[model samples]
Target: MAATTIRTGSGPLTPALAQQIAGDTSHIVGFNILITDAHGTVIGSGDTSRVGSFHEASLEVIRTRLSATHSAAQARALEGVKPGVTLPILLNGQAVGTVGITGSPAQVTRFGLMVERQTEILLHQASLLRSTLQRERELEDLVRSILAFDPLVTGHSTLLDQANDQGVDLTASRVAVVVHTPGRTPVPSTTSEWLPRALVLLRESFQHRQTIAVSISANRYVVFAHPTPDGMDGILSQARHCVEQFRTHLGSDVEIGIGTEGAGPTQMRTAYEDAADALHLGRRITRRSVTTIDEVRMEQLLSGIGLRARQRYTAAVAEPLMAAGDWNTVRSTVIAWCESGFSLVGAARRLHIHRNTLIHRLERIEHLQGWTTRTAVAYLALYLACKTNEFDAAEPSDS
Candidate 1:
């Protein structure tokens, strides 16, 4: 889409983006406008007939990088000329094109300058978008390379050289974040219109920091994120905000899994795997929309058991009581108590109940579950079983 964008001030200014700028500026200002490339060929004009024609007034402005004005009398001096003001379209201090207004030079000078500034702003935005897309594609390739190859295997040197050429520091600290939509394994499709929209949201949302995100599949996005000097908490906070945005805008309950920060391509690949694992496990084992691998280390360790084994273990610890109507309440109380560091007062405060009431609920749970929750062994058993039940219920059922 180079023809649709100015390439971050580095490449030729093409007609598609120029036409867009012309159309948008004309709409805003209620004026007839024309855009000419540095070569003086009219690339865009409010009057379509003017396109592909020469604009004599813009040539001098393009060459001199300055505004040029012409009166009705001076218009006769040059072929295909008009009485108007033409100003150079400067992006990054280089004149890429010219924007002109057709009217009395004095009357149109203000409008011409206004449109010129607007065009520059639009051009800069297009350039930045082009850069962001390019970076995203490169990062996608880099991530795939890192994930697919080992350092000692064939093509390692090629991967290293590619990273170097892309100006990515392969050894710098990065955290992998996997964003996935609910209910399916990812099926990658490069042709999905959804891909660009998702990539734009991710790149723009994190533009303040160094984050490269790509649509790895139809519903899965991977981001290689770098934090500020402080730590990862800031980035993760931003990520949660993005999750909220996704829910509101994308019509999907998207979840994020964050991996611990690591350096080197190999470690970054591991971080990617960890992030994916966190998302997979978190969706099954918890109600959390955002999961960090560090926070789910125990769950990860426990995930190795077979589904049948998990089903039996969870049934043993959670059943009978689970058949009762107030099982959700009991489960919440158990979770709250555990979250409150096993303090009755803290748990009572969190549940907004009296301490005696919390004790009564705990006693009821112990009576029905056939195990006292006071002992370390029993407490661990009950909690782990509750989590296992969560995972088991979340799994896809067979007919």
Candidate 2:
């Protein structure tokens, strides 16, 4: 007769199927199904009343990591209960319990062999699915960590705010602080021990859970910290302290910039930008020190110049004038003009120079450089050139 396919029954070994399989064998096919907990406590079984039954053989299956086998004789008194192949039932990739068949060696072995073969296929498929699920979870965790960053830092606030707002339910009461590691050497290529150590210091000092989403670039690491009700000052102070503690390892002077505190998940990017702006200022102005975006009041004045333009302006004007020795005076003059709305009168008054003296200097500048300060455009260009020249003067020759 065709073998009965009891794929689904009262779970593996019901009395009916067991009797059928037992009857098919020439010898007695004695068997018992066992169940156990994570700690080897038998909780239940296919047998009706085995609810609290405990079996040493069941424990052996877990401890020894071996497949089940049938035999005419039991192994030993202390070997738990020995029987045919013991089929382990697993949940969550852990063996929670097992099923076993016992009887005459030949018939029991045949039955066990059949059951073990089919069970192996099922278990292998299950194992592959479990592994795939686990990998998916790990990938999700990494993505979540990256998305948690406030994207407003890179000059795309409106778009980032909308996208993140639609995608995630972000906490509204948190703030972001940007810690900038200057130069190429101080920062490592990846987020390894040395980099993570700096992060640890920041988290500890601020008393917040710190998460490194990912590296923004080779030289920039974005740190997200929840804002405390104590205020931005406390947050900034902690950042300052953290930087100071790890100053030596950081290579370049460590400058921490904090963004403005605000509400909504969309606000993170804005906050990040604020902090980054603070860091940028800190690096350029406060060399070997810390600076905050709040302290950089001329963002409005410097708004029109992009990074590349600013660099070129600095190299062209500031570098040369600085090299020529009157950089300090030129800087004072340009700053006065920028601060005074580019009015020659206001600039002169601020510098305590006579209008005629200012006029004469202007004339001399035009004559010496073949450039005129007659129009607003010319004045603006001169102003930018002068500022660049000033910065170049301050920089070392190698820089």
Candidate 3:
């Protein structure tokens, strides 16, 4: 019985693997098995005495990359022949070893072929798994190297070279996108699994666009993409799409922030910071799923002030209202009124209430704070205080 070999460039099957195959097949077919390397020296065998022996038929099978069967009489006529079959084991399109079975010609022929097929399948799976693991490690290392880069340093030639080696062009124009998954806890067990899935989804969505995405933390991911002529609009659209996909998969809301496009590796640090700041300010100012740097640039500026100064500003303008039981209501009324350009009708319309109701709310706010929204200074103070309160709320605790 002759069968064509499938050549795969995998390494020669080890004695341990061969012995495992023989042990497993022994229970099903009840045949004595011998496993030989490409050199035809027996490395594994059901019969212990046959190990280290040479088999001519196994050598022939390896040389021709085919299977050979021998009848009992034919086996007896040849020196060191077995009344069974010898089959070449092929992996990655190359013959790596041979398997021989000693039993009745008909029984061993069928069983030996089955064993050879099983061994090839197992070896192929093992090779594939190893390759996948290696690729994942390489990808992770590349991401780490990129994040570790300090653009402000004088000598980044080594980092640039390493990035080039990984097919990432650090000199190209790139914009950073930060994805924030709200309410996600940073538990290692869950985040480790979740990040890979998110990365896969991002890659699939932006693969043709030459995007690079990496996990920055348990609930944050950074994606770099080269923007087209459409500029921030195109970037915002891509970010919105990613957030929508994440929402569909995770069944929860996600917010995305996009930074301005910047050139070269050094600018990546600034771009990443911009994206993160946009994300934070966007969550505080708007309910949109995606936010771009342009949308929150003013908030970004305001946030740069010292935290203590901002807290004092909040105290000076909104201190009286802060002690009220309905502080949130008072704050919302002031924000809506300011956002409406001090127009009672516009504020009432925005709040989905009658104009009279809005006037009552404003009067209550004025009474509580001892200041009416009449003068330009009053309007300015209230606006600044509202912004400061938001900034304070978003600030991380010192503890």
Candidate 4:
């Protein structure tokens, strides 16, 4: 049966929910149920055929905010209704809809009241869910605006007003952290479905602190956290804990990048970019799940050079290696060596090769390319080229 529907000037009750109430309540109570909006029209009913009928008893209940019942004999007098009990569905003490059961008044009155209470609870829960979603949307919009804000623009005052209304203090010092799931599978991909799950998982981690978290886009979540009084060291420590919290719930696939701390809009925006860059570098180069801007500053600086120029530099520095298809290995070797502090033993261990093999490879590079990592200039250039290639490959192709 169809449940009661809300039409123009009907009620906040939607036809879909009314039908759900009618179908579910009837199944549970083993009786036919009819749901009516404020206008007394059945939008949903356990008996699908009765939908769109008017129940005069329901109209009276809506008007009086009370329950009405009828004996089997009295049921004949009411239009579009049988001998039953109808109770107003109250939300905040106002009737929004009615739930009616079809049976003798004495037999159905208790079940009618039970259905009424159930419908009211459902309506209230729906209202709360709507409110929470709306607030989340508003908060996301606020974060988007703040991230896009430019001090030279005229909208700063308006943005400040909005932030003030939301009880967000823009002047407070905050460090931006960007969390992303690069290739999420076996999990929801839809932003609306995915965001809440992640947020709920991280809610406990954020409960003690002031954090403004939002999903800026698909798979990209940002959290502007208030830095603790202990400064950079303390903030990073907190960020590590936060990363562990995320990974514990979300799994090892999650990656997080942390930014520097500062107050106001411009710095906050910069911090967001910093965190994003850190995440990019961490994911592409180190394959690390948690990365801080401070840890990747050199790579970040190297990334500032245009991809084309960096490509040219890499080509120029290792021209012979490129021609012989040895640059890829050299690049890997250089990055690993540099990262291992140019220690032959550590570099060999990192590459899972013997020291003699490493020495022979270096000898082959010098003999064929005449490029040795013996001097500071040569080592630095080679190191930068390797780093540049990592970032360059990560960059999206302009063509």
Candidate 5:
């Protein structure tokens, strides 16, 4: 014989889900439960033998989309039904299925309604969760397109139209911020799992209507937010707040870099590059959690030089000191003197030494290098070389 089919407005209910709902309800209420699709075909039942059977009362409930109660006499008059209460399962204002409890009508009538309500709630929650996940994926894709920085891949005109449809104005002053969490051992299998949580924290921190955030890598997230009128300071403050929020709520140690504000979509790539450069320079120079491109402009400029050229410049400028036997002392003396604005007393105090001792060191440096901290050009060269050395030393080594 051909199998019977049940149809609901939302579509036919799956037998597996029906069976699970029936089993859980039976366990809680201690009653024999039967679940039938809209056509009254018994898809699931607490009594396994009753599965795949037809129930006349369930058919009546489905037809009327109402609850029905049957006594022993009424059940005997109907086919394939016992003394029980049958409740219609409705989804979107249409009967989708039926839940029946087989027992004395007086005892199980209330329990039947309870089971119907629980089943409806479970289905509603599942539907909502599915919708939420779908929306998140769509937003993530849009963000990836925006950050991709490749015109051929992201189709600039199409993206602009989509952003407009989504109520986002790409032609606005915005800063790009990158949050990086270093030292994560054995990176998680899926970084996207943590991204939603991070977005939540960012939304709370920014409190702005037009912010876009997405994870660009396993350890980094990119955010674009419209800047306040106060300019770079305002952007930096927000970046610091974001760093604190991630650390406080997510227990993550993060370094945040804020880019110079770009006026429109065309400048987003430049802003992102600036933020990335700021992050690299900040990590090299300071222990601060938040850094802005403006704070590292000099380093950013210096970084544009080729690596070999920078190395050559450093070697040529500081070659005398590099050749000294006691290079460490000579370098420290020059650095301290420059940092103290070429003040003998200040440099001596910073070195925690007597004036004469500091003078002796400076005199030795001059004798060994033929260059003195007395000249602005010599001091500037030494300072730049020292910064280059610091940058090289701070660069991470690969195992």
Candidate 6:
């Protein structure tokens, strides 16, 4: 067969066929055969020792794109050796790769041609199968990498859920940010290319202060943070700055949206959704190249309730306490209480205080805020506020 023809009919060579070809051509003494890609990468070989060795002959095949016969006497690397023919496997009238045999010059010439013919067919089949399998693996990795991300596109919640299951000390102090490239088409051919690089960059930036977990999907990347000694705002600001710097090297059309703080992975899903929402808002309201979740007014926590009723409820019950500037402390206390299952000890632990100290803080908040833990209405409002207030502040502006 013409070398070009063999190269063109690329297909995965079955082991059975490979063994058969090897057996048929074993008559030549110590004949070694190697198969490689156009780039000279060894893909397969008859000798196990050469499995990873570079196929130097691939360059000759790639350049000439034709069959070549050489005597070991004439070749420096094969000096005082046999003669063999290195046949290029051609597919679609092009040199895709090569296969060859080495042994006695006269006997090698005849046997090499026959072996070359068989190896050509085998390697062609092998190449096709290898290509298909590679493509499948790439697809699977893409899906996994994408799903590992916290955003809906990435399912970051799933990963965080795992962290929680492992009994990682999860708390509101831990935070994450979801950054998206707005209005830019995602990398069309592969999802892994830029996502991994972005994640590596994020990890490097967060290395000393906190653990950063990254997830990448078709369109976005979510960064999950382990508890950090630094303040959330400061860590977030530094992360954002890093992302901005990274953006400068990306394709010009790239845009990014940053999510608000989230304590752990479970809550990260909500944060991711919020960030996506903010990105939507960014596309609509701002002309800036990057947007942040905090920059968007969060959806009304009580939007489900009638506006008049919500206003009346807040005014009558929450307004006076909130006006005293003790709203956050009270709200945090209530959340701690509820989250602790009303266990004074647990709540105290969460508050990082001794039980007596916890009681003192609770009593002071109750007295100053007029929010008694004994009152069911007070408790309920506090719960709702805790559940909802994390994102209720007025939209932030420019950082």
Please provide, for model 1 over 1-399, each residue's C-alpha lDDT reduced to its tens digit, 9 standing for 90 to 100: 012222223454678777777777777767778888877778888877777777777778888998988999998887667888889999899888899888887788888767888788877877776786687688778878877877677365687688888877776677888988766543323443333555656666555444667777777888888865656787678678777766666655778898877777777788998898888877766659888888778677767888789878878888877888886787778878877888999999999999999999988888887764467567667888876665555665651
lDDT of 2 by residue, 112-198 (tens): 655544434444554565564454344334334434554555334543354364443244455666766567534343543333455
Q: RMSD in Å for candidate 1, one decimal?
A: 8.7
Whole-model lDDT, model 4 = 0.78
Q: Write the per-residue lDDT of candidate 4 for residues 232-303, one digit (tens) a residue.
A: 676667666766766676564677898888677778889999998989888766777778898889888977
Candidate number of the best TM-score: 4
Deviation in angstroms for 375 in model 6?
A: 28
TM-score-wise, the better of 4 and 6 is: 4
Task: Compare candidates 1 and 4 on TM-score and give the better one.
Answer: 4
TM-score of 3: 0.63
lDDT of 6: 0.56
What's the residue-level lDDT of 285 in candidate 6? 51
The lDDT values for all models are 0.76, 0.54, 0.73, 0.78, 0.77, 0.56
Q: Pick the candidate with the highest lDDT.
A: 4
Q: Which model is ahead, 3 or 5, in terms of TM-score?
A: 5
lDDT of model 3, residue 51? 65
lDDT of 5: 0.77
lDDT of 6 by residue, 199-267 (tens): 555566556443444445544655555545566555556566666656655443434555656654445
Task: Encode model 3's per-residue lDDT on 1-399: one tens digit a residue.
Answer: 222232222454666666677777766678888778787777678786666666767777888998988988878776566798888989877887888888877777767768888878876766666665665566556556665667565357876676677677777878888887778633323533423566666665555445677766677777887775777777767777777777677565777888867666567767878888888878777658888888878679878988788888888888888887776777777778887888988889888899999888777777776765466578667877876787677655651
What is the TM-score of each predicted model, taking all chains together? 0.60, 0.43, 0.63, 0.75, 0.71, 0.36
- Angstrom error of the Cα, residue 281, model 5: value is 4.1
Give the local distance difference test score of model 1: 0.76
Ranking by lDDT: 4, 5, 1, 3, 6, 2
